[model samples]
Target: MGLNVPTVSTGKKYTIEDYLKLDDGQSYELIEGELILVPRPRTKHQKIANRFFANLDRFVLMNNLGEVNGDVDVYLEEEVVAPDVFFVAKERLTIVGEMNIQGAPDLVVEVLSPSTARYDRKKKSRLYFRNGVKEYWLADPDQQLVEVLVAGEKEWKWIGVFDREDILTSNLLPGLEINLGEIFR
Candidate 1:
């Protein structure tokens, strides 16, 4: 028998409070008062995300810049998102509450998977930009590429795209560089 999945009523606009009441094991994000189901990532996606988290966490810890986290609930103004990987700067550490991040993170990384690439590239990026996230990284495992974007006055400005042999650097995290080969490996 298939597992009984929890269901939310149709046409009902949900809030963060309503989202929190969900006890289902599946992952979900609240956007525009709607609950978006997050599909489980594949092995390649997991590896890329893990590599990013490892490198970022190590660098941030060694430099005492801030904290690095993976797949944690982030509470924005009216949305709750779980970035693949994220960093909170030392100055904004207060936003990292016990249960979930209370505000926008300094850097938000999303590993692109076939199921959610469109949302990650457009809707989610816009949401993060509007919510004060300083930087956004979209890692594409299939393409062996990473695209960096910095928040602009009105939208997200493209920084650059790095390939397998290139080294990825961040404007937010100065002097912090990551080898793309290692990330895509």
Candidate 2:
């Protein structure tokens, strides 16, 4: 048996603005300067996003923490990131830019799907921390766990890793109590 295999490569080369402007009925994200197009997920992913956003929506309203934005383009100078769910505190609500979020948000929450887990954990995490993002949450929909990151003196420090059994807490929010089960249930 002698069969030679051929390598096939395919993807789009897109800039930050190009990727942002492409609302061509496709679900995609920018990772490491690359625009990756993702197919629609299984039903489970939708459920996780719904549950997490539902409770987070209530928490922000009750505590007056500005707004919880989903599918919003947030600009960090050279980088434009779109976290699964992002929370901007009232203090940083003075953004007056042309076509992007002015700066870093108080909290950036990412829901882990197979498509963007590595990019979220590695590339964007570094970007957020470097730009003085206070809190970064990595929510694992498959595992039902969330990893919390807080800005530190040198770098972003891992404050804690929480699961469904634990009550999610945030230092930036003062008296905010988020139920872990509501995230990935």
Best-matching candidate per TM-score:
1
Clashing pairs in 1: none
lDDT (10s digit) by residue, model 2, range 91-144: 677752445577787788888777667767887888898888889988887788
Q: Alpha-carbon error at 111 in model 2, in Å?
A: 0.9
Against the reference, the lDDT scores of all candidates come to: 0.89, 0.72
What is the overall TM-score of model 2 with all chains considered together? 0.81
Candidate 1 on 60-175: residue-level lDDT in tens? Answer: 99999999998989999989989999999998899998889999999999999877888788778889999999999999999999999999999889989999999999989999
Candidate 2 error regions (>4 Å): 1-14, 20-23, 96-100
Error of 1 at 94 (Å): 0.4
Please give the lDDT score at residue 111 for candidate 1: 96
Give candidate 1's total backbone clashes.
0
